[model samples]
Structures are given as C-alpha cells and as structure tokens.
Target: MSNMQTLRFYVTPSHNCSYLPDQKAKTLFVDPQMRISTDSYSQLSELGFRRSGGHIYRPHCEGCNACQSIRIPVELFKPSKSQKRILNKNRDIQVIRKFPIMDHEYFDLYKSYIDQRHADGDMYPPTPEQFHQFLVEGSIDSWFYEFRDTDKKLIAVAVTDHLHQDMSALYTFYDPAEEHRSLGTFAILWQISEARRRGMNYLYLGYWVKACRKMNYKTAFRPLEMLIDGHWTHYRQE
Candidate 1:
C-alpha cells in the first residue's frame, strides 16, 4: 500500500503551546496501531516529525509556524569559538553510552534537574514512571549516554535514538548547579562528535522555536539545517 493508504494520523485538540506563551497548539500524531518501525520513523523525521516516548509527533498548530525541526549535518558542522571553549572546559568529563536502563541515580539527577531548571514546565516534578516511559520503553534503538565528572559523579544524561543513517537527540538533563561548566551545550557537541565517529549522516536536534530563548542554543551549531515547508535548507546566521 502507498503512504496515503497505510498511514493513519490524528490531530490533537488545541492545548497551551509549550514552546510559546499565550498561544494554543495542536499536534499531528501517528496512530500507535501502525506500529511504526525505525525505518518509518526515519522517513517521518525527514518530514519534520519527532518521537516522544512511544509516539511520533509534529507540531500541527494552526496559525503558527514557530516550531521548526532542526538537524546537524554531522560532517559539515564546525564548532564556533564558544563551542570550542565548551569542549575544552568539559575535557575532564567522561562520556559513556549504554542501552537505556532505569537506575535510582539517574532518576535522582533527573529530579534535581527538573526542580532547578524546569520548574515551570510540564515535567516540573519528574517521576520514575514518566522517566521510564519517556526515555526507556520507547524503542530498541534508544540509548542513554551518561556524563560523569572526573570523580565519577554522574552529571548529565542525554537520551538518544539510533537510526539507519543518523541519530536523534531525544532529551538532555544535567546538574543545574554546574552552570559555568555548560554541560547542556557540551552534551550536544559530544553527540555530534559521536555521530561523526559512528559514520552517521545527521544528528537530529529536535524542534527549535526561534522566539524561545531556551531553544536558541540549537542554532549555535553552524551549517545547520531546518525542515521548512517540506524542504531541508541549510542555514547560518551572519
């Protein structure tokens, strides 16, 4: 069957937009009954979709085009002076990739991250159930990349998905107290480097809302690409 015949989707009712304030948003999601495969998800990702937990979703909001899917063409990405600085600073931090697993230590770091950084967001009070559901039980290709300090103290966790030719960064949380170390930026830089090392083509960075300051970091990676109006276009801020 063709895509038109095999694919099933539903539009969510308008809800408060998470990326933008005072605006309502809707999402178009693939029916779980479809039992989407990693291959199918890769195709959807190129079409500007993202995976959250076990569901594939994209912003289908009406009258708003603020949400744009962003990716880093691994081979073409060149770090800026600031990024280079971040890399140098985090040289002591060790990165380890593991199959997604549930551990109390990870959840504890998650709780502290949410409490300090995401207090106003939907995940304010992070829970064990939500953590496993969102990061662990999603798909077989999922991985948990842990970042630890020189002393072996876990400092950050980056949830990622491995695909045929690329990897998607699902979510990242870190010790909010380590603000000066800039663990968030370092995590993304590490992922891009890892993707190149693994011979992956692109590293999907999820949605970026230009107006949202929290998302501005996604644009820092140069020679970036954004799926716009069904086409992927390379962009670089002057």
Candidate 2:
C-alpha cells in the first residue's frame, strides 16, 4: 500500500477567467513543506499537481478539466529537425544548476521578459522579496537553472523541481533580446537532454492551452503525455 499523506484546501475562484472564456477557476494545493517526502511529492506530481511557490497545485474547478498536466518522455523525445536547428543556433550558451538565489541581474531579466511578453500578466514587476518567496521558500527538492553566454551574461533562467522519476519545469523566463533564437524552446530541449543524461524518464511541463499561442509551443515536443480523466495518456502526431 502507498503511504503518501495528502492535504486538501480550496482557493477562491479567480474573478477573471484567464484561460477559459466566462468560466470560474479554482484550484487545490498540496503543501510540500508539511511533512511530505520527496518520493511522495513526486507521486503528487504524477497526479497532476504543479509546483508553484512552495505548494503543489492541481485545478479543482466545479466543471472544468481544461488545465491539463503535460510531461515529456525523455527516452522517446526526438528533437524535430527544427528543434535541432534551434539547439545548434544557441550552442554558445551555457547552463548551470544551483540552489535559487536572489540577485539583481536575474530580477532584471525576469522583469524584462514579463514586461515584454506578459505586460498584463499578474507578475509584471515582482519585487526581489516576492521573487525569492516564489522560488526559494519551498521545503521540497527544488533548484534553479541559469543560462549564460560565453561572457557570462545571464540570458535565461528556469525554476525546476527534481522529482524521483522526472524533472518538473516549474517556471522559466528568458531575455526578450534573444527572441530570434527562441530561447524558450531551447530551454525545454536542454532540460530533456539533461534528464536523459541524469537517467530520468519524464519532463513535466505544466500545461498546454490551445487557445494560448504562447503556450501552444509546448506541443512541438514529440512523444508527450497529457493527463486526462485522472490518467496520463501518451500523445504523438505520428
């Protein structure tokens, strides 16, 4: 029998239906800081709880399952010819993983990315304290990946969770100045490669919204799994 302890809580619905039109949105959160082991935390992730701040959350709307938990099978992930081209385009960039730390450069890049990409989004100009709380206050296994150019200029950053069987990409941001290179796509490709190198199976990408073009890009990765009706089902064009 599985020995994973669980916690339950409900969040008030958001006034604006960001993803769905004229629909109320609510969520259920599991706090990893509250006596949850890394293994159990990974199980919750498989059950579709996305790590944010320090909490694992899955949608619990009254009548909606639009928010799908998505993952990439590292073994079956074959970069499309275009994806390979993107990787080759940015081969000069270097990636490093470390415990999350607050700094001005990261904050600056974050702000720039948000202001340009998500001007009306919730986290437009988050302060350092708020960024730190969102990225560093968790008790579960978490870390940040920093990407820099040869001159050590910070270009992109990803806040990821290392699960027992997979790597959960919690959040990521990149310099708008590098838009031509498609840094966002490169980041995911890099994670998939890193996961295979570390002997991990899956890369948990949070969600995919067909209506949201910004999110539609996630579907470009082949051999992905989408959670539906309490189960993860594989998806591939061919």
Candidate 3:
C-alpha cells in the first residue's frame, strides 16, 4: 500500500470565505512536517489539493461544497471564439519560461496588479514578504511564464506548478494598465498549449464555483473536468 493513503491531514478552523461573501470556509491541509516528494505532490493534486506557498490544501467548508476542483484535458481543449481573439491580440507579447524568482521587477508587477485589480481582496497593500511567501517559497517544481511586450517590458506572469502528467495553473497577474490585452485568458490558453506541447495530460485549474462570478470564467475552457464526489466528470454549463 502506498503511503499516500496514510499521510497525515489536518483541517483548519472555519474562516471567512474568500470567494463567496458572508459564508464560512474550512481547509484541509496536509501535515506541514511531511516532506512531500514530487510524486506525492502529484498524488495530492490528483486528489484536488492545491499549493499556496508551501501549504497544500483543499476547500472543506461545512454545508458549502461550491468549490469544485477543475482541470482541462489538454488534448481535448478547444478554445472558444473569444479565447482565439485573446490569443491573436497577444501575439505581440512574448512568453518566456523561467524558474520562479524573488526580484523587484516581478514584485513590482505583482504589487501593481494587486493594488489596481484586487484592492478589495485580502492581498491588498501587497508586501514583499507576502509575495515571496505566496508564489516564490513553494517547494513544488514550479516555473513562471514571463509575458513581455514588444519593448521587453514585463506585462504579465503566470505562476505554474509542474506535476506528473499534469501542470497546475497556480496564479496569474498582469499590468492592470494592459486590460485591453486580456492577459489572464491568454495565460491559461498558453498554458494549455504549452502543456499539450510537452505531451502532458491535464492542466489543473484550482477550483470553480458556479455561484462566484470571479470563478465562473474557469468554465470557458471547453471539455473541462470537475472533481465531484471524488470523481472527475465532464462539466456541462447549463
């Protein structure tokens, strides 16, 4: 029997929900003391766990099962018409894959993104310590896709984690000034392309909450599979 089944788990006490307002949420976390190997990380991802900094957790809210783990079947994904336009719009933007780094340029982009775009969120007034702890300090095999304009100025970044037979789309941030570029959608489309280019099987998108307007965009990717009741089922938008 694999130790993956025996790994220790902990549930965090209820806290305010980040996605749905006026609701409580709980999280299930793997024991922080355990040294998770790449294989173990992949297994956890398969079980709907996501990495936040070095912590791997999944939503375990009481009376609220709205957060469903979602992923794209790389080979089966067909971009929508709008998604195609987003790709064409960003053709001038160059994407470079690089290892995650803690640099001022990256932090500046993140701070600007949070300030202008997510000011009402918990990450408001983003700090260097918070930036490092959220995206840089993770132990997972992670890399970032740096999106730069023709002038070579940084415009956006896609933080991703590599897993066995899959790639996890962790987070994406962009210059709010470049709103017309729709960099967020382009980032995911590019990841799906990159994942297929590498012959990977799936691209794990963290979670989808139908009632959360912020999370509804995740279903834009076709042939999406959602982990429901411990099973991955095709998602049909009704």
User: Which has the greatest lDDT?
Assistant: 3
Q: Write model 1 residue lDDT over 31-116, tens digit each, in one string.
A: 85667677778888888989888788999987889999999999998999999999999999988888887889999999999999
Tens-place lDDT per residue, model 3, 1-238, is 2258667899998899998889999999988777777888898899899999878899988787899999999999998899999999989988898898889999999999999989999988899999998998865689989999999999999999999899999999999999999888999999999999999999999988888888878988999999998999999889
Number of the top-ranking candidate, with TM-score as the measure: 3
Clashing residue pairs, candidate 2? none
Count of backbone collisions within predicted model 2: 0
TM-score, every prediction: 0.95, 0.92, 0.96
Which of candidates 1 and 2 reaches a greater TM-score?
1
218 in model 1: Cα distance from truth in Å? 0.9
Q: Look at candidate 2 and tell me the lDDT of residue 128.
A: 80
Residues 46-158, candidate 2: write the lDDT tens digits. 88887777676778877667778899999999999999999999999999988887888888888888889988777766778878777777747787799999999999998
lDDT by candidate, in order shown: 0.89, 0.82, 0.91
Error of 2 at 213 (Å): 2.3
Cα RMSD of all models vs. native, in order, equals 1.9, 2.4, 1.6
Please estimate how well model 3 matches the true structure, expressed as its whole-model Cα lDDT: 0.91
